[model samples]
Target: MATCEADCDAAPVPLKIMPKDYVYSLLEDPQRILSPPTAVGETLGIRGSFEYFHYGCDGHQDAGWGCGYRTLQSAISWIIRRRDSSSVSVKDQHVPSIREIQQILVNIGDKGAGFEGSRDWIGTLEEFYVIDVLYQLPCRILHVKELGSAEALAQIRSYFEEYQGFIAVGGISDTASKAIIGYHCSAETGRVYLLIVDPHFASVPSCRQQLIDEGYVRWVPVDEFPAGTYNLCLILQP
Candidate 1:
């Protein structure tokens, strides 16, 4: 199986150009999901072999756009209807579950929709899913509005100001854990800068470290920050 880094960098494998007429059949048969376990010794002889090829070796490179199904619901339907009865194995390395696969498809679909002029749904979905999956929390209306506002610039700044500590900690959690922190400013340029710091996993410390490492230079403890202070300067771009 390809390591995360390798899959991220390699050129995406082209899915076997199956005939158009067979698309439905392929989706209907789980055995066709990829290479079957029994055919492990043979080259290109498994069910869903194409998917595994792309997922394991290509890091789901074509995840969001090329595949026929675009929405999460459609992807789930495809998985459940087609692969459930086939002898495909979920135990293999790099095999994505129904949820993971759907998420990937949703990301791609969402991106395509955005670039093709569906910014509202795309932005909302992006924010919604990121928070939902990462933090297991439903998005508040305020959060959604801020994310989609024409004043994205002001909102982002305000977010940093109000949640500087939370931003530093990366995210909220019942238990502390390390976080990968980053920030982007659309005002100067659409670039994201990553921070460096080793806060405890799922803990405030990890989030804090993530912010510091990512170039948040003005971070302070929540207790130390003034109660009414708001607005933060953007200083890093990546």
Candidate 2:
């Protein structure tokens, strides 16, 4: 037997640290995580219950049946009850009120607020929640992962390319990152819009220019695009 100077057990084995790319490559396709857009109406009604109740005022009620719920809390409850009732399916139709449409807008705003305030956002939590709700199914919320600068946009683009249909909402800024703006895209319409929380105050145009220059996005004048919805592509950097 050979006499060893050190005990084999005494030396600690080094743990392998995975490179970010290797870890990223291991991730499941982002598109697979999304519920098909066919479920949008239902998901909107469910997740946006709060909006149904709050924004679906008399003006909204006059506009549609979906406007019956007059408070966000009530709308949420209604959605929950509907889910439990087993009578309503995604295909089971119900006329929504104008108020319901208004609620949708409000809910989108609320979502933006939540995203901005969240301390940890890896994109997974929101994605899972949206998928589960849309599918009328449940799933485990996994570990959160943060996207680095410009990485978020890349992720969004990948998701869109794979799914071919879905909306993407993001906080975008110029190279400086100081002048930031939020954007929302409609997959079906292929339309993208610049959202301003405060219309009285506007983001610097230079910021938008910066995003274009960096090849993070392409800018189309509002007049040319005309804003309802249009097909578009993500212009990535070389």
Candidate 3:
């Protein structure tokens, strides 16, 4: 009864939609939500299912500094779902919240003190550490200084085909975080396309279609991508 009483007095953990609960969650399939408006090439996308996470989740105010965390949550959500596809129950496979992620870094010595409670931003490297420490999962990072690299694009397409999972992308000029769930290359015009699910949306629209109608979830050509060093975090599954 003492343990029960303590549990009752402790704060309640916010209920997060598990990977298997997409049926009950909002529309999150950005890749298939709306077809590309212009004529693009054949699209190759994630093999397994995943979810989209954005700002204001659990009532946390992380607008400017939480994009990477939200992107990481989406990417990690895919891995958890894939790993637990055969399992009977996935109630314990919780995606770490922003505060939990911050605390984990501090606890594991990955981040120094004063980082747990701060609203500091994180990048792809921090994402790698968090995924490694949390799930012991290995990740392949493609470090390139530009998005127009021919070899990098080839390898990224191959990654989607091989691993068939979501990729966390960072290093755009504005330093926003996004997920690359699908890729396309135009054979006629020799143009490159990417299906990006941005995590910087502060207010999730009341309707799922609004998210797509807006620029939050859409196809962007490589030429339109901001100029900066590009890094990709590819989570590999066994």
Candidate 4:
């Protein structure tokens, strides 16, 4: 999303498939590492599987503003590998890089195949457009006016229960964009927690456990989230 030196006019690069262990969902031991509150009642996570994408994963100079792109890339990877892919349809099968993503958006517009790259950072709304463009996939956007309210948390829980796909969560106070892959409810204290996978930083992980150790993927309390007005981009996979 920012400072990507990839050529926007060059041919699209196919997403490199990492080893199964490198993928986030395939990594075990998160249950062994977590120190969640004993007050939680139910815990839910993403249904199928997903791969992790981050700032420096693909050799881009994107450190500050590439979070939205990384988040969207991970979501697309999950859709491509989902179990119900018999019905899945997309303009392209392989994942696209930052340059390709910008190119696709420009092509769909009146840019006429001439897109000058900018340093603009994309948010959850831009992610929605990218999914619609590449996958022709319909998505849902949930606006949370209040960050930690029970009603908002309930809606998030419902989405996890029904869809079980990764969601991109952006907020007014949250400087970084995060993907919500799990949810928990504390019956005793009526508190809710979110299992978020952050796509920030430039760490080259040797294994998935490194990410967990560094807190790139973990459970965060909803109360700790930034002040209100969170936009959730939910990609609906077929």
lDDT of each: 0.25, 0.26, 0.73, 0.69
Deviation from native of the Cα of residue 171 in model 4, angstroms: 1.5
Regions of candidate 4 where Cα sits further than 4 Å from its true position: 1-40, 83-92, 110-116
lDDT of 1 by residue, 1-238 (tens): 0001101222222222121221112112112222222222211111121211111112222333312111222222223233334444321212233234344435535344224321112222333333333223332222222222335334444444443211211111211111112223333333322221222112122332343344322212223322331222111110
lDDT of 2 by residue, 1-238 (tens): 1111111121211222121111111111111222323322212101111111222222222222221122112222233433434554433423233323233323434254343322222222232233323233332221112222133334433533443222212221210111012233445563433321111111222333333444333322123322231211111111
Candidate closest to the true structure, highest lDDT: 3
Best by TM-score: 3
Q: Which ten residues in a row have the lowest lDDT in candidate 2?
A: 171-180
* Number of clashing pairs per prediction, in order: 35, 11, 0, 0
* Sequence-dependent TM-score of model 1: 0.22
Q: Where does candidate 4 have its weakest 10-residue lDDT segment?
A: 1-10
Tens-digit lDDT track for model 3 on 66-144? 9999998888778777885667545467777887888767766768889988999888777877777666667787777
- Worst 10-residue lDDT window, candidate 1: 1-10
lDDT of 1 at 150: 38
